[model samples]
Target: MGTINTTTNERFFVDYRITLNDGQDIKKIAQEICIEQTVEIPEDCVPQTHWDYGITGIVEDIIPSDKIKNQVLVSISYHCDISSYSVPQLLNTLFGNISLKNNIRIDNLRVPQSFSQLLPGPRWGIDGIREKLDVFNRPLTCTALKPVGLSSTELASMASQFATGGADIIKDDHGITNQPFAKFEDRVQRVQAAINEANAKSGTKTIYCPMLNDEPDLMKKQVDFCLKSGIEGALAAPMLIGCGAFVSLRRQTDLILMAHPAFAGTFFHSNLHGATPAFLLGRFFRLIGADISIFPNAGGRFSFTQEECNELSDALRMPDNNILPAFPAPAGGMRIERVSEMYEKYGKDTVFIIGGNLQQLSDDLSVATGLFLEAVRNCACATKEIL
Candidate 1:
């Protein structure tokens, strides 16, 4: 077991460093870390909320290490016996806010002898999602309902058709906002209603994730609204808003969260300073309670390679031996035509989201949707039988 100082009671501390942008100061960074103990959780674990599961750890130390870039290094010690909790849970409680809040990096975790046995990662992982989705032999198909300029009725209607036509998860385009023509509340209620209608008639429980990107308070409201209306998940971009926002939302709600890749491009773009996408998006997001994280698949609009995509999938699906696994959703320029090949490449633990291709299939929404659905079902079933 890894011990900090072999002297007395094993104390668990987080050795971290924070780097500020140009013109930033240590005092400003210190103030950001100056927080009191704010315990988060619910009265009943079943009715849990996001704010209830996390703690507010303040910056305890600051260093002037020239070796490190615009960074701050600090160590946080926790006294509670964490032997009962899993590693993912411990990490979530410790540095869940690293990327979302101020510029901070968790260089190392000093686990005490008492809690060293806890495994840190997904339990069922990618294999589990495939089992749940029942697509083991091939890649999964995914799509998005985008260009949030349409009205609630339009969006809901599209959702209904998409569910009927066979898209696995009809997510909102990340760019969609709560505009006048298509308000968030009205759109969510209508789209959820449409999805419910489709599910009842088709015997398929398709998920409808609303783009719940707003201010902190409004974001919470959006989540609450989705839950009340029976929405399955939410489309959120952590970098654009904050990962802490999603963490808080997950603690409060019980819906699966599909993380979007927006401002996150900046982190993975760099080589030396920033964190890796697989570690941050695949591993950390799961720890922070994201059920499904959306990323740019290789050969799509973004530049992530096939190897990078596979590595990310492995990270997300890898068995944690301790924690629940989150699903890996590959979006950005995905299509239904390549469903089979994508499945073959990505394996079973994937939500292959097709966004723009759905729009180009045909003007007749119903026919286009039907074609897409047929392809997905055929591919998914064929893959399953082969497996």
Candidate 2:
């Protein structure tokens, strides 16, 4: 029952693709979302003045889907101020309540230019990270110090080996938080020490990025600890810590932020519901300041398809007025043997993360990582222009 003030143009729009099963009416569901997402009142009882001000969500139109059967795209418009220009509020306004609904997915969205600039997305995006590693014109290489349960000394030794082999980055696995087996401080310190020595010996610029988390205070403390030890980058699961907290860290520090997709699958797992993997992992994470966004590689260990990975890559690296391009890291059980294929897929503007395959190929981790480096640097599709 919401009426639009056609005179007012201060609004944003979202294209929601709704699947019409059981002969459901597209018009009713669109109106229902307008009511449910906004005023939370019965349509008949909605205040006249509120409608005059266009206070409730408004369905711009219902466009029949061209791609899928029984699917329709509803374009909804919301007053710009409703989101308060905050990343968290914008997301909540976009998908908070509707996320629980069946067969509704966010197909695409648009916000005003001013609104998009409220938060400076990605403190150190793809170019900044490439500068930090001093690797350019080729796919950058990264690996996680992983498998948990390892002592800090063991992980640090692993770090030294990877650094010696000239990998661009050696980061902590998302699971390697403040576990008692190798506490955050102890592990970060040891790993940095090992990488530092290796860099000194080999003249490589291998950055050590620890997984930072906990309360904001604790995360700041962790950053301080790492900064003092000459560490310049870190990783965190934005969904696990909340996107607002993640942005705060980006605005407050200079660390290159690597975003993990942990606990994010709940938001984009179903074909009939939730956000798309490209939207949540690539577009959303890039907007919230992920210098590098990591996802499970297609054909590696997860269910992501080639089309989905392409969408994700486009969302991250595509030029945008508001967001700088971020590195799309196709990771999670990735193998070194697929380096050439992955390079052809993701191209040079990517960060390839290969974990256990390095060890599986060689007893000497450095030799394994060296082979990884060689594989990536000499891929058939490559034309390196290191700067």
Candidate 2, residue 37: the lDDT equals 80
What local lDDT does model 2 show for residue 4? 51
Point out the worst 10-residue segment of candidate 1 by lDDT: 46-55
Q: Which candidate ranks first by TM-score, i.e. highest?
A: 2
- Pairs with steric clashes in candidate 2: 122-289
Candidate 1 per-residue C-alpha lDDT over 1-387 given as tens digits, one digit per residue, 9 for 90 to 100: 222222233446665566778888776555444332223332233222322222334355667656556666666655434322444355555555444665565544445444423432333345654554454554455566677678888888888888876556778888786989888898888888888888789876677777878898887777777877877677788666776566666666666677787887776664333455776677667755667888888888898878778777777777654557777888778776777777678755567677778789876555676776666566668766453
CA lDDT of each candidate?
0.65, 0.85
> Candidate 1: deviation at residue 135, Å?
7.0
- Candidate 2 segments exceeding 4 Å error: 1-9, 380-387
